[model samples]
Target: MDPRQEEQINAQVIAVFPDKVRIIVDDLEDFKIAEESLKVGSYVKIADNENAVLIAIIENFQIAVSAEGKRDHIIEAFPLGILRNGKFERGGDSLAIPPKEVQPATISDIKKIYEDSVPKEASFRFATLSSNISVPVPVNGDKFFNKHIAVVGSTGSGKSHTLATIIQKAVSEKGDGFSLNNSHVIIFDIHSEYKSAFPSANHIDISNLALPYWMLNSEELEEFFLDTEANDHNQRNIFKEAIIKDRLAKFSGSASEKQNIHLDTPILFDIREVLAYAIAKNEEMVNTGEVYASSNKEKAGQPKYTQGSLHGKLTNFVNRLENKLNDSRLNFFLGEQSMKITFEETLQKLLGYSSKSESNVTVIDLSGVPFEVLSITVSLISRLVFEYGYIYKRIRCAKNPNEKINNDIPILLVYEEAHKYVPNSDLSKYRASKVAIERIAKEGRKYGVTLLLASQRPSEISETIFSQCSNFIAMRLTNPADQGYVKKLLPDSLGSLIDKMTSFRQGEALLVGESIILPSIVQIEPCIHTPSSSDIPYWQLWKEEWKNMDFAAIKEEWYK
Candidate 1:
């Protein structure tokens, strides 16, 4: 240690309370030299230019002195280059101390960073974390979910589990949010998963679900009854009009009766009914001239009428409709099935049908709903919610200032298989799933109706919907496309953490966005109630099989 070297050792006490110091250097032209050459976390020594003992940069930079009390000026030694007999420190005179490096912080550290942020999930019941891997923080009116949210992931990547977990969590919250007087949730179960997952939900199995014929307008009914064989636009309308009239006559309330009248409106009729009517009329039209029936064959003199152009058209339509109804795949929408309840029953149930008391929560299960009409049913339900919200908001703010409004009640729509509805494509039109989701994403926030989407395919989800989500608890996504999609969607600050999604354990998620201070990789708490997402252990089943059964017994047992 030298005296002259002490002058070259420049340093400053930046933080006195914590005893922190900043090393002063001539030029950091090469950060590598500064970083590697200096002892980031160590004691320092210094020497003077004349190679004389100067000071030791320890508790305070001071000249070294004898152990026995000696001089007023405490001399310190500063090393020009740290020397341990044979080594030469490349950097300048003084060294800086580095903080202790911790390899990785605990899961609580990850959760706390986000939990302590704005629009915080301060007080919500903890649900199954993303995929049961990361902790799920259920948000309602008090949290950011009152705005908008989006979830994305790859197929079979536990998107459905994540969504189901959220719905369950929200329902729990609503039941617990004793302050709220009403909470009506209407989910559009596109895949029928929601219908089954939440049994308490008003399940509208589209199969048996029928809309009151009078509810449809003339144009809608026309579209519904558009004849395939009748290529001529004019001819199609004529047939459509006829079908509408028949349906109105059949379902409408009678004019004379003043109640339950028929034929006072325009509506859609079953293609079967329309076809029968057209066939009978075509026989008479054929006798007239321009319009005619094909056959005439009655009891001898009373000849029966044959099929005509109108009859054929109507008959073909009925056949097509019948075929569609018969197809098991398409039967969910048009089939005559009893597995599901009617739409009217569902609607009434949702609107406090039996209970005079307005409930704060409603779950619409789609498990019994058919696959084909799942999307359609979901769209209709979402539309109904949107329409009601619009109406309620208006009335609350309308004329009477003193009129009480149920503003505290917020309806949250949860989608279990969210990616299907908001796919990566331009789902701007031609998709019932897309339209329903987009409506919730675009307008639900304003009316206090929030949406929580859960999906595994972040890459395949619609960008519009994904971008709207301000808060996210993303689980592990190993697929590169899905990882890339989330990376693209999240903020730049989360780059370091998101890069680890592929390696994250199932149920573990990266929590970020408005609710988080810094993006975190969290280990979520387990769900209170277990959901139905579990794999069958084939090995366990095989172990139970034995040679004690005959062919019939084996077959029966195997089938069972």
Candidate 2:
């Protein structure tokens, strides 16, 4: 901050606006920056007459030649904040008519912007400034996670690695305490990529995942069992009546108490019994003096028969239900474990809680799950967690009227490739999942349940869910739609700053929102336990010797 540095003017501030500043250097050979390197996302400092300084991020570069063949380097930057009186302020500005001088921000000057703004205790450092790896970037951990977060980028842009890095840091850092922390995270890993990242996590894949058919809500049940093309009202009514009767019959309560059980209740009932009831109704017979096998036939006995009201109505419904039951892939839903598993045990598994050793993460590997029920699976799980938070909060408040915390052990639900389940489309298959997730996005904050949504295409995700995200780590997005979608969610002041997203290298991200002290371009630190997301080196592998294959084993699993 010495005034003597002003004597060596490095660049000229030609134009200054509320949100941006333009600087041009007439002599490229004598640019003489501290680092002797410059890039579009680098930070620079400009001083006004009162000795106050403004920090800006370089957005774009342009070069022009004069008539005499002299070159001028034009640097356009977005103003981030102002530093005055040894105090750094974020996004408030006042300036004298022509700024005193502009200079490439020295390392100390740059560090002051981030270090002074956030308290040491609240900082959660997982990445460093893209311009300087030595300068670490820390965000407010509570605000970042309590509020929903989004991590979006194109394929091969390190979106997976970035998410893994944040989660690893979260689980590993507990203020130099014991080996484990209460931090709980459940990742819906569509491609089974996170097991390596969290080796000790409670991993559940199709082989052992037990999602009872009785756990699905009414909407999910309809979507799973009803045919949208046929849209049969009789079939729906039959299914509803069957489940309700089945639930009532299974309840050991009084007649009046059985009235409380509805079709959508989470109470466990035999789906097979419901299927049997449907088949019986479809083949039911009634008598209206229709046909008689009488004395003309012979001596033993005689009977009259007629088709009942719903005799043929439920034929298709029975077929669909029967096919679903027969499919071996869906055994996870109808398996004996699911029928026997209690709600408390299922919750413990999802929350990574146990009397023995407990882990901080639960990875649900969906790769082995059947595709037809993906939405239903996601919906059921999300609903379970949200209800856990809601009911847990209610119980705490009931016990202690002054209890402020909803859940003593809060949980974070992460959806890798979230768009696949919660796409913007209004298709029937996505309805249940969308409703479940959208409810969380709107109300989960108070109940201590939050989401971390990571996807390659943000534009394709549900807008209601995306808009609820208070923080975003946007990496290199080459697609215009994805870029524009992100731009719309951020503040208008950051429009130019976001333009630098495409130019970022792999693992570089524009970290912005309520969590961080300042919006900045940062390089995520490499995770100690990497995910299985690395791209294959096809060319080099092809040049090497032929690799052996185990088609028998592959086919064995494939058939199953």
Candidate 3:
């Protein structure tokens, strides 16, 4: 290189540490150039020696007057990884290089560094760097997704678009011949927005998404069917006994099998029959002209029948149960007419691989579902998927001990508006879904089940769940609380990047963690089929002439 070019690139390393470097900018012209080029979160390379290059990020900068009253501009950077020879090694060793050895990395230098650092296998080109030169950022798909991931941003910050892009890219076969035939992704579509994104995806709304009523465990049943706070102890016991008796009779088999039927058993049983038994027990009378206590084990000392102490107490409970049974909105659970369909069939419908003609992505739209039973519904579906995946992996592992575990068909479960279900607050009302999802977040990876959690409020999400995530795609989060939550989740080395979240564009995100070689700002590629979450054009709609309103039809639909 020429003397002038070398001098232009060279900068003085004022101070150095294991993970960070402090550079001093003295030349006015060079400082101006550095100010323009070395942006926060931008990559830089420092020459440790002729054979080794230390890569770092410009985290912060300061302008101050030195002891001699001379102006000084200092750039603080955190070392990402060291590139030695042609290979990339994580972390940097203590270097004794004198001042003026550090060089401001050029675009070509960065390209070479990224090309050598990013692995070829198990990686995909997803986004490009928003820099002077357009450089494709190849991410390790396996590493990014194998561990849990969180995609969080405020409203209108491209959270939905970023998620859609990821799904589209995963299922897209146009480039790299990536086949999603074996990929099983179930999206819990909260607002019915993603139905059109993947035309080949299996779209399941409340109309066709039937969750067998018997799938609810005891806690879920209590949460949905009986109001524990309102119901007395005897009423709850009577309800539990009826459920056990009905489930045992429905799944009658060998003596050993009958022993397995408990209150929480996931067996197909008529909910109406259980309700009838409970009512009958509530109405049953004994010889003492009193209510019969079916749950009372001490027969000798018990009042034979005192008009069934639970008769009046259970009226509200029975009324609630009846209301739920009759609710058309809850037909997904109560309207299962196909008695021939077994649990295996339901599992296949929920988790089966979609062929080329079929849709691989199954979106469970919860928009039409009633709010009261929404949590239990989500719990049932999430629990079923987790249990099925857990059992499948165990059986597969037992059958072929020598086979690789990754060979199993992986399922990616996407939870939209996750904060509604998995809140960090201990007093959250939705415990059923929270517990189910937390179990998956903690243990799903071993069984080939991954989670993609998208939320508008990171501060509201469960800390345990958020902490497990290995990759983060954070967009423009203006809220200070949200930004602080994200900052706490990130490592100290990359915490400065969180400050830039407020300025990110719609589709731009800070990609960090196990996915990329280093934390970077990426312009995510546009999804081919956008979701139905676009903002409403209020101005345009207001300017247009109003059409004739259908008052009668609107009223009738509202009543329905």
Candidate 4:
């Protein structure tokens, strides 16, 4: 090799470590190609004499003043992966002792790492490289959606926008011909922000939502109606007994199944009938058989009566049950409409499968759901998706046992602002949702149900659910707890890169996990239609002309 060629290289490898490699830059302005100068977050390739090349991202730069008053530039970079035989494989530190050549990664080099590694048909693009906006980043679509995804950030940090962009690209991207694709997405829009984004979606609010109350499992039933604060054992036993009996007596199914009924069975059982049964049990008299004499036939036998064992025990339970039945706010799940609707019909509305409504996205606006029963609603929906997957898989395998690829119409459930219901606390109010969602996080993928959880307060989310996420889009987070919580991805070789979370601009995020070819800091592309998540321009609105108040209208709407 000529010495002049070595001098023209501009960058030289000085050192290599397990997690990072050191490089010394002879001249920063020597490279007039690659579209950019070397800086933090830039990708570079280091090669040794043995043909082993390692890909690394620049972390920080330092300037050292020599004894001769000369200045030297040194770069510290975190090793991302190694390029072997024209393919990029994750896991670094395979380079030999002293690397011979170091240079900025060309556009082609960046593409080879992010795009060429994944088949063009399997690529899903939602963002571009933060260092080079022209380079679009692609992730393996199957790995991304099949596994759970977590997107967390501070308020106004573009979490909603990121979710919208991903889903929008998914639903609109067509394969062969222009017919409807095989994509199905159900978004639990807690703040009612997704309807505007998916205008054609099957948008169901509390007014149109008919989630049956009978479908709730025992835990959800107790969490829904029973006073958790009281913790009365009698209330629980009586409620369970009443529901089982009511179901057995009313079920028109085969007698054998009725005999095998249990408290957790997802069958139709009247809550009003359960309340009536509780009332009857509470008011029963113990003065029946022996206390009544044969003299009653002639003397109208006046037999003494005693209060039944459950006389006063169920008073509070029955009263609370009746109050909840009469509460208009709770009518969405408790009313006759919810009971009349079959599980298939409910799934039709929720999955956008009904003949009347055909769409790829179903946004269940949860803002109108009563806060007290929010957990119950989320639990019921999450369980429904999981069970659908489980049942669909069973039926498919029953027909064709050779290959058990279940759930042809796979679904992804998006929980926007997930912490409101599935919080980390052991409080009984959050138990229902936490259990249902955690089950999905653990085993939903096998049955074709995956989760896309987006929240601003990630530290408050249940670890059982949050830890199972295989993909993450961590945006700007200002809170220390959130920052520290997200920084645990350090094991992915993000050393000092994770420290930049505090300063990332809106729409920029640290993209990592099993989906992408390599972890990257990316700028989320502008979504086709953004969510209604922008902050209210208070100061801008205050400059408008004074307006009259309408208290009467507000009061009337509040009552409804």
Task: Please tell me which predicted candidate would have the highest TM-score against the true structure.
Answer: 4
Model 3 stretches astray by more than 4 angstroms: 1-3, 6-10, 17-20, 26-42, 49-51, 59-78, 97-100, 173-180, 289-306, 338-340, 352-357
Candidate 2: tens digits of C-alpha lDDT, residues 380-468: 99999999999999999999989977689899999999999999999888998999999999999999999999999999999999999
lDDT of 4 by residue, 118-189 (tens): 888898999999988988999899999999999999998888889999999999889777667889999999
Best of the two (2, 3) by TM-score? 2
Compose the digit string of candidate 3's lDDT tens values, residues 1-560.
33455455436788888667888776535533334445666666777545777777787888879899988778888887777777776666644375335656666666766676556766666677755437777778788778888999899988887788888877763445554446678898888889888777887787777777777888787877777666468768878888888878877589899988888887777778877877776576646745446676666455564565555656766777788778777777787543345677677777744332455688888898887777888888888888887888778878888768733778889999898877887643487888888898899898788899999899999888889899998889988999999999887766456678899888788888787787777888888888896578999999999878999999987776
Q: Which residue pairs of candidate 2 clash?
A: none
Ranking of candidates on TM-score, top first: 4, 2, 3, 1
lDDT of each: 0.49, 0.87, 0.76, 0.87
- Superposed model 1: Cα runs more than 4 Å off: 1-122, 125-143, 153-165, 174-181, 186-315, 325-345, 351-368, 399-409, 421-430, 515-518, 543-560
Q: What does the lDDT read for residue 176 in candidate 4? A: 79
Clashing residue pairs in candidate 3, if any?
A: 200-359, 290-305, 290-306, 290-307, 291-305, 291-306, 291-307, 291-308
Model 4 alpha-carbon drift over 4 Å, by segment:
1-10, 31-35, 288-300, 489-492
Per-prediction backbone clash count: 82, 0, 8, 0
TM per candidate comes to: 0.59, 0.92, 0.88, 0.95
